[model samples]
Target: MTHAHFAPGRRTFLASMGAAAALLPFAGAGRAEGTSTTRRYVGLYFNGAWDVLLGPDPRDPAQSYDGIDLGTDALAAAYRDPIPVMMAGQEVLWGPTMASLAPHADVLTLFRGVNMNTVAHPAGRAYVNTFIPPSGVVPKGDSMGTRMAAAGAYGDLILPNVSIGMPTFNLVFPPDVTGVRLDRATEMTDLLEPLGDMPLSEATLAALRMAQDEVEGCVHEQYGRPPVEDLQIARDRMRQLLSNGYGESFDLAADADLKARYGITNPGASNDPAVIAATVWRLLETGLSRTITAQLQTGLDTHGPEWATQQPQRQQAGFDALAALLTDLRQDDPNLDDTTVVVFSEFARTPKINGRGGRDHHFAGSVLVFGGGLRRGVCGATLEQTLGLAAIDVATGQPDPAGRVLLPEDIGATLAHAAGLSHDPFRTDPLLDWIA
Candidate 1:
């Protein structure tokens, strides 16, 4: 059933993130596609533990996984491009549908060999999102987006950090700054500061003007740039634009065919990859948000029979959905031609397929990057033949004699680099090369 809106002060969630509602007038995708200056950097978090492999491809040809010695590296090279880095370590997760990204690889940047101290899913996600976790009353740092907004005080068009789906503490940034969570990801804007009652008396109008002047003055003094109350208010208008079906740009129900292509039942969940992709694409088209993440969860750890039996089906569905979503994004929003869409997970499955016909979690898994001026083609080493992880040299996509284990910092640094932020705004470590 459709929920009217999240209870006040509770999580706000976006409903009908499927193709069915996208065609509706207020999905927001139809909002003017502004110039590149309007759409800046967007960060995405692939929530949940996702397995990179297990795609929709139908070919039975065997392939290398996470630098395993599958013995078919030579033949596999013919079907799958050789990734020299996988041999040295830092291979990402992959399944049959991995090739779906082949068409858009040129405009993307890839990362491998990243580490998150713990293998636990939630802990790892928090670390990836905010670079630290909460310790009881000791509050964690603010999210990257909050810092961006604070820094871009001029409203001079810096990218907005956006996270879609779920109420995540990761969205919370520093200095007691935190984002309001929406139970519905689509109606996300409602969670922000609300406008006062309309058609106010002269006294109320004077108050608004005073408030605006104060806000403008503060931003101007701090940013050393001219005031932008106009732009900020217009952008702030986004919060209310999603009421009812008025902002149906994200609704896909308008297109019966597209809706069918995505999925109707449990359409936008960790179980449904396409739904995640499509929802994210809609956000991008609005030209109102930057740094949007569409998380795909479930199926990475196979501890029981149900997971073992259902893993393949889930993988296939997710992969197919992902492919469809990417294809649609390219078709719908030409603006994303320079946008980078990444598919990531904590780690890869073990080299050896377990007795249950499932793979266990391994340190080295694969991550995919699409768009944003990529180098194109595959890098790193060829597929593996058996059950041992390989090494990688980030500098040359060759083997590192000491053996390289993917470090989480690499991915984190790469993301910061992509969005033009300092991994350690405090200048902590060397920069990562995922963007370069």
Candidate 2:
């Protein structure tokens, strides 16, 4: 019923848990790597179902001039004449809002015919992130980000996994391997500089630190040996995070040009997806985190008259942010070749527009991937009449009557492999064709 229901002070709870874990004797054994040369994974989730016909459709002009339209002015205007763009030297029809991504087409790959099975928000979100379909609404295993953080090599990193404005079920991960959630980048600044308002005098600061240390020691004594060591490790980690200058990555005000490029401005009424994307980029670039997950602006559910105006704007904002992020990754990071970015919706919209000029939920959807040596091009197809999924040979990424339909599980498996993680734990097969 409220934002609290979805977020529920998750950031604070995680911070506290990390501090408690520091008190344990073996907590240091789970620390992440101080320096990692391996690749990073970033996930951008577009909440709600996105309309595939609005983006790229395989419909014939004879069957439907403009695929399926809900009759909204916005949809009609945008979808009436879909334009074809060359991506990775292949002709592909792109949605009006996707123009920003055209320049980076050489590295972009689109996957259609993704079967998500469910339209329910909770289940869909969980399934897409974790690759395991929800039994009744709860996730069965760790998400890809959590799994990547759990890898032994990343244990010493300050924050191996970072999630912002996204639904993350970390209970499935090991207690010390959990990710940190922040509602906004500003909150991250606050966490790193909790004493910003306190006295700056050396004596005053020292007294405050001593008081805090005394309290921590008292708590450790009360909790006994195991907890005491974990608490101590957590305290040392917090100090390392502050001293190592990792929090500086969250300072968006330093570079005005960079902020403008990512559409980040001073705080306003709502959080911008561009700023979130930029934050993820900075985290990876600075080695503050190895895996990051963020949600773009919601409201893609276009269930009524709102679809006429709201849906187009929402789609455009998401695409523009993504385009900027990709550009920065290529131009800014020296290790760009080692990073992978994935963007996808839980499912797609219905083929036929409903009476209210809106689309209902559909089982089939699409996904976009770039960087990390993935093959650049389009894969799979959809039928004209029903806009249903078309099976594709997993090995070749080509359409086949008897081929397997691409599913979220396959995407998850592919990502796991890209991160050099074991897919056997998840019991899913990777789409090897996408890997380069």
Candidate 3:
């Protein structure tokens, strides 16, 4: 409903723009040559910490049942239903909630050793989006979405980055390059048709433009460049919005079967996970956006006694929505061959169940990456004793006794690299195995 987060304070937004201009090379860098691919990205954020034990784990018998001790009998019962999936000739176990994604095992790769570094929700989410470890203060860096949009591939796009039902502070890029957030898919049409039935004649439109231009000239001369620049950017955005045929992407009335497949039974509530996934796929399919970030309506923060009962439902909803999205991409989306999907949570739930029968936040998390020629099979390892992430060799994406823990920065850098963006500015090393 409220889109206030999309509209940052004018002063703050302008200051970010100025700062971006000062670091032109880093912030505005183009994609590397010889890496010019039409690859697009979709970032799916599962808000609230997810429990990794609910999914696949490293095959260490000693560590295989780490979380069971803290769970109730009901929670322990859930583990007995894990589905075995064969990936790259090796069998991997997927929890019952993830059974929907089992059919696509060869295309999906799960990572087990991601360290978010913080247990706090806001900081964890920020770290995943901005790829910069938060120091209690908001990081000045832009999100991977913003950076990918700023790259040359989507430079001329009307709305290169779109955030749907997601709280984002993607401020690293220039003001014009920042992402636009929509509450729902139909909002795309609302934005494009704000005038409704109040159509103006050509003469009236021309007169209004002339008046606006004259006033803009006077403001430029009287005030300063910042205000004028901001006004111009706003005007340009409006023009681009009107010229781009983005509304077509939201025209789902004729595709009843498609809607059903995506679980969009009610068109009014687009916040449904199925609808959210459908909206993002439509945006990508229609070339309306080069990068999309969407938040699922299902919550993963099961911090109460009902966690065992609630978690499976939430995870199943997420997995089903994602599986449906992938189905459509593989069967319908024209950009399927050039797209990559990354699904992750801010953090993971603790291995030990808390007093309330629910899990608290943990420092480690897991991620699922599919499409874009990525290799199948799991990367990184979880420790057998603590159920924590083990150190990994970035180059080999394997466990090494002397390696360091894999952090959110490494995952972010890997995503940037997969999207063909330059990762020289990021301090984290990319997981080379993620790239095909």
Candidate 4:
């Protein structure tokens, strides 16, 4: 495989996070109120560099090239021409593979010209996750999902951050906010189940619980109560997980109708894009987590002839799965409005295909955001000549001589702001115009 490599241990979760205090709503500070009232976030990431021209960004073949260079002898081409679609009354070009998403354009918030600033897979992936560049392949700070889990309106949910086959990091948040990592959806169901037969009868369990509560009460009365009372909360949450009906609710095989909708033939083990989409929906619907991140597609680091044939197909399948997930969310009124979804890849492919009939990594990339009361429109642009990122007016997302370049940090800040967080953790202002 001619793919980028990274340190394998980066995916390991922190096992010693101390229990976190009960979550409190983050202050909105003095930021202007946009229309977003969402408290939950869902991230769907493609594991490798993707060819944006076949999805969110494309050039028309029939039109004049003008200053842009198509390379006189390039061998591969997009399987189909770009399709022009009107989004928010503006004509936008959609690549052939993104057809499934055309119908949902009204809610789409496409951010183009995002400068990933690195072609290396590890750096780019880490950049997207935390909006902070890594230090020699080691991720810095907390992942966006972890921050959300710590600051969002988590209420009484036990698992605030659930990451399935996704790279999640936590360097600063409370230990309780650390992600509950799992390889697949089945693991979640298993984790919530009781172990073997009950070792103690109900009477004994009740007596033990009462005894602990009394001991904690006495400690609290003497110590003026631990500020967050987090340890006790953590204990209660663990008991709730073991005793609740969550085992049955999360059993993927129990819902035949849901399996059919997502085209899941093998429920627990499958990693199909559609199956991942369904898993996201299940997590959200059950109100089990405040933030969820999952890898929906992989093997996109195409550096050979397979680029033309395999890349576009994989991209399309992922888009189709996303569209299906949206449709399912629409079935329940207000579901879409309350949840925010983001789709992105580590980076983008080079504009010109290489001699090997494939493309290499590029710095400029695109991201798709929708739901959560966000407006539907494009937020930035790339230069036509080199397909490189262009500076844009942050307030309006338009090209200007004095404009600044867009970065993943801007997106992170925007999302944090929408979640009513007052702090500028990403050290950038949110794209105010992107708000509904």
**Model 2 C-alpha lDDT per residue in residues 1-436, reported as the tens digit of each score:** 1011122243354344354443323321343343234567778888887776666443433344444653534454654445678976778887776778878777777878888888888888888777767776776666656665654355466666777776655543444545677776556766676456653777876786677556544444645643544454455666666677766577787778768898776633236777777777787777667778888668899878677677667887888888888887887554345667788887888877778877889888888888755677877666555677788787767788899788877777776665555566557777787777
> For candidate 3, what's the RMSD?
4.9
My TM-score estimates for the predictions, one after another, are: 0.62, 0.83, 0.83, 0.83
TM-score, prediction 1: 0.62
lDDT of 4 by residue, 54-89 (tens): 889888767655544333233245456778888889
- Which segments of model 4 are wrong by more than 4 Å? 1-38, 64-78, 196-228, 333-335
Among the numbered candidates, top TM-score falls to 4
Best by lDDT: 4
Q: Give the deviation of candidate 2 from the true structure as CA RMSD.
A: 5.0
2 or 4: which has the higher lDDT? Answer: 4
- Model 3 lDDT per residue over 215-329, tens place: 5333334334334454544555566667677666676665787688887777656657877777777877776677787886457789887678767677778788899888877
lDDT of 1 at 164: 51
Worst 10 residues of 4 by lDDT: 1-10
Candidate 2, lDDT over the whole model: 0.68
Off by over 4 Å in 3: 1-29, 56-67, 70-72, 75-80, 170-172, 184-186, 195-197, 213-240, 243-248, 251-254, 332-337
Q: Give lDDT tens digits, candidate 1, residues 1-436.
A: 2212111232222121111211112211222233133333333444444433343111123443443422223223332322222211333333443555544444444554444445566556555544443343332454444433222222322123445553334222221112323334544333432345454677975686567445533333544554354334433443234332334555554546656766645533333556555555555555545445545545556633444345544554555566666676667545354455566665555545556645566554455556643343233432344323346666554457565644555554444444444555323343343334
**Candidate order by decreasing lDDT:** 4, 2, 3, 1
